[model samples]
Target: MLLPARTLRFCVATAAAAIAVTVGLTGCGSDDDSGSATGTTATASTTTAASATTGSGQAAGATPSVEELQTTLAILSDPAKTTQDKVAIVVDGEKRATNIESMTKALAGYGTLKFVVSDVKVTGDTATAQVVISSPNGDAPPMPLTWQQVGGKWKLSDASTCVLLGFAQAPCTP
Candidate 1:
């Protein structure tokens, strides 16, 4: 599961590899906001979704509804979504078109992943989502994902997206 040390930077090689494998291993799970899948429902409590406040240059957006985060995250983890579809969903995804394609290919046949959003916090326009990847296979420990408010919508952050791309051996730098 270990990749060459030189292949790692912001995402350690082993962790990156585990992510790719984790995506493939999960069955189906459901979050209160996201759609239903076949895996075990998360044990964590889902807070009531808050109305979103648009984030600007240095202002932080309010805690988004679980619906918003689930909606955006569903697209990010769905391998079947097109590159263009993904491009529009991630922060700075416009420029990471090629990198996105690489990840899509790497994750192809893994099917859609399910998740539970355990927590969310926004600092300025950037935010972090604590989530657990779920599947019929099992549930991963909670992991933090980055996000950003672009224009007015929440998009997965470029750094996190690139880490995903890295698992596919795509040459991307966050």
Candidate 2:
């Protein structure tokens, strides 16, 4: 299976709502005699942002600082936000909001989430950066991320949306 059922159950709590980087799994291959899933891939029908005004849609009004983006993500990643507020800091947040419940669950077992960003670059309404997500459990490998200036704030680029949502890697290309 591409994504284990247990992993999906754990991370799909808020889906893209939190932009937590939990890749979606479209299907899980049946287990062989040994009893193990086969592969993981994520696909979703809801692609476009519903209105683009979800918490993720709000713009920064200026070029976003790496620290600012990290702080916002930390707040959005909080599992408590599910009941307190549904302000998801992600790209096309309205579309991602559809899976808020799953995203929330993904954060339940994690410790405090931390992000380190470098090589901030901005050009017009687009930007790119090196990012790493870390926690007590483990640290995600650093990767380059593309961001878009939406409604004056920096949001994950569509390419990022494609990757996070379990779509093609080529979609990440400019």
Candidate 3:
């Protein structure tokens, strides 16, 4: 069945949000060692900051154009920025993965990531964007990405998805 563009977008967004929540609640680590544990916090912080900045909208005292968001997505999708790690913040807990380099390697053959912004809701320095990512293999489900403004810069607050395996978390409760 052919789904409406809006419906398709929503589906993708929902999937992304679900993944984000899952990864956020899960702990990050490999069975091998704990030396890399410290990397989790650092990576999470960086990812959160970058996501918030990229997805963020206008500041409480200023107005940022939509172009800013577009630019943010572009930068986030870049392979270079993908090294920022993957983290999720859930209602009950937080999940983080510091092995971003590994994740990138795994996704290397997955093809480029193309994000489509279906809709955006902005309030002050915070905003929730409905986005869908398409890969060479296929299109991923839609996901909700949260953003916040800090120091007049917008960054990702929570990707809601894209967490590493062990670092994945459960969904947040409504």
Candidate 4:
């Protein structure tokens, strides 16, 4: 239940794509549910840009700021954390709490999920980052992942989570 039914070819979705439309979900390559971003645009105030820095004293394209690294750490947290807390670090978290839980458990035995973030772009509340993810299984190719600012805090976008869940070939369709 780590990845969605689609080979995780579904794994490399862009948050830019999710921000531009309503994302849809499906079963992970197995039982855990994750999804894809498709269809129309959203109604929220939207802004898109590739920034060199988020102005928090950290350059977006250079060394990842403390905030950015923190986000990456949240994604790789100990599996013992509550699903609610885990979900809190990702966009649309409440809706995908179950899938998050399933994926968390599935990877618990594998050890931590590791990542490196670079080439980051910040647009208003949404940011796109080039990321290389590694799990106990191995390292996945470098990819673009979207991040969102919700309630004044940054969280991994749902679309990005969908792709990440595939880190170990687990089915995460939502």
The global C-alpha lDDT for each of the candidates, from Candidate 1 onward, is: 0.62, 0.47, 0.43, 0.52
lDDT minimum window of 10 residues, candidate 3: 38-47
Give a tens-digit lDDT track for model 3, residues 1-174. Answer: 234789756765566565454333333323454332111100010112222323455335343344555445544334445444223221111332343344434433333445565456666666666555554334446555656666676555643333212122222223
Considering lDDT, which of the candidate structures 2 and 4 is the better prediction for this target?
4
- Residues 28-73 of candidate 4 have per-residue lDDT tens digits of 2234334321111111122234446555744443322434544544
| Model 1 C-alpha lDDT per residue in residues 39-122, reported as the tens digit of each score | 222333344334443344333455555567776767765676788888898887888998878766655554445667766776
Question: What are the runs in model 2 whose C-alpha is more than 4 Å off?
Answer: 1-62, 83-88, 161-174
Q: What local lDDT does model 2 show for residue 13?
A: 37
lDDT score, candidate 1:
0.62
Residue runs of model 4 more than 4 Å from their true location after superposition: 1-73, 168-174
Error of 2 at 60 (Å): 12
**3 or 4, greater by TM-score:** 4
Q: For each of the candidates, give the backbone clash count.
A: 6, 21, 23, 22
Cα TM-score of candidate 3: 0.47
Q: What is the lDDT of candidate 2?
A: 0.47
Q: In model 3, what lDDT does residue 53 have? A: 29
TM-scores of the candidates in the order shown: 0.66, 0.52, 0.47, 0.58
